[model samples]
Target: MRVTLPASGTEVDVKSLSRTNAKRLGEINSKIAVKLAAAKADGVTEEERKSAAEELKALLDEKEAMIAALYPDLDFEALPNRDVLALIAMTVDYSLNVPEAEIKNWIRSGNGEQTQAA
Candidate 1:
């Protein structure tokens, strides 16, 4: 799958992960979710929050490694975060065979219709 970076407009070629790599990706995602939940739980201490942040950063690094393996030409670390996020979203959308209209609808759902004050 080919996707254009949102900020730089650079095109990237992404490959679907093999079953083993996909499993690794799923594990990384699960770890991230657990860390996020810990960080957000009520009565969390500052130290615990910091620990969660570090864990989340490590998980993000793992995810970047997976993405780099799939898209060797992409300098994933150097790209702006916005572009990286856009690239990830596009890659997942393509991998899942999501329609463009569905993506547009999802984006629209975030903001709904805007109205002007009378």
Candidate 2:
């Protein structure tokens, strides 16, 4: 399964997905692959790049909220920024049914900050 790490543009494929969800996971992977590839190849405009990062954060937040709602026992508000990013990446990786460890590693290595091009 291929999981897109929002913090980084790299798409990683890992062998871990339930047979039932594998197809859906492939669709998601393709979508992310296209978006990242377009941005990489065409060179995302400054504004578009900012928008992408914001969109990623918003998506992560939405997923986090959903998880919190479904699992009331889990505390989602108390984690540090890095941990929160890691958690979000992990959740996304899981939702896509990919390898959580690879996603976590990618998130851990990400800068998570926008740097303007000079």
Candidate 3:
């Protein structure tokens, strides 16, 4: 399947990722998750959280960097919304490592709704 990078014209073949790509994505996403969780759990006011979120958007560069690593041919260094693209990468990677049923369970746990067939 094709996954297009947000704010950029580049596209990635989601199903073409290799084990190495998945591992790299997992490592990078783990770090991103930590930062995001910490930002949300800091007990700050809404305005403060908004400020923190703006700062946290910088992490999108790291996500784009990982994608560039997986696809050397792509130049995503200047792309916008790297975090969104990175998320798509993670979903594709996770899908490859699990069965359809497990993916469905995972999605339901996240958004509290059953996922449609892939």
Root-mean-square deviation of every model: 6.6, 12.2, 8.0
| Candidate 1 TM-score, true structure as reference | 0.71
Residue-wise lDDT of candidate 3 within 11-100, one digit each (tens)? 555444567866765766676787677767857688866765765576556555555565566554445655345545445655466553
TM-score of each: 0.71, 0.39, 0.41
Off by over 4 Å in 2: 1-34, 80-118
In candidate 1, which residue pairs clash? none
Among these predicted structures, which one has the highest lDDT?
A: 1
- Model 3, position 64: C-alpha lDDT score: 56
**What shift in Å separates residue 12 of candidate 3 from its native position after superposition?**
5.4
Candidate 2, position 54, lDDT: 67
Question: Per-residue CA lDDT of candidate 1, range 62-118, in tens?
Answer: 777766667777787788888777666655554556765554343332322323334
The 10-residue segment with the lowest total lDDT in model 1: 108-117
As a whole number from 0 to 100, the lDDT of residue 46 in candidate 2 is 80
TM-score head-to-head 1 vs 2, winner: 1
Q: Considering lDDT, which of the candidate structures 2 and 3 is the better prediction for this target?
A: 3
Superposed by TM-score, candidate 3 places the C-alpha of residue 62 at a distance from the truth, in angstroms, of 2.9
Give the number of the best model, judged by TM-score.
1
Model 3 spans with C-alpha error above 4 angstroms = 1-15, 42-59, 77-118
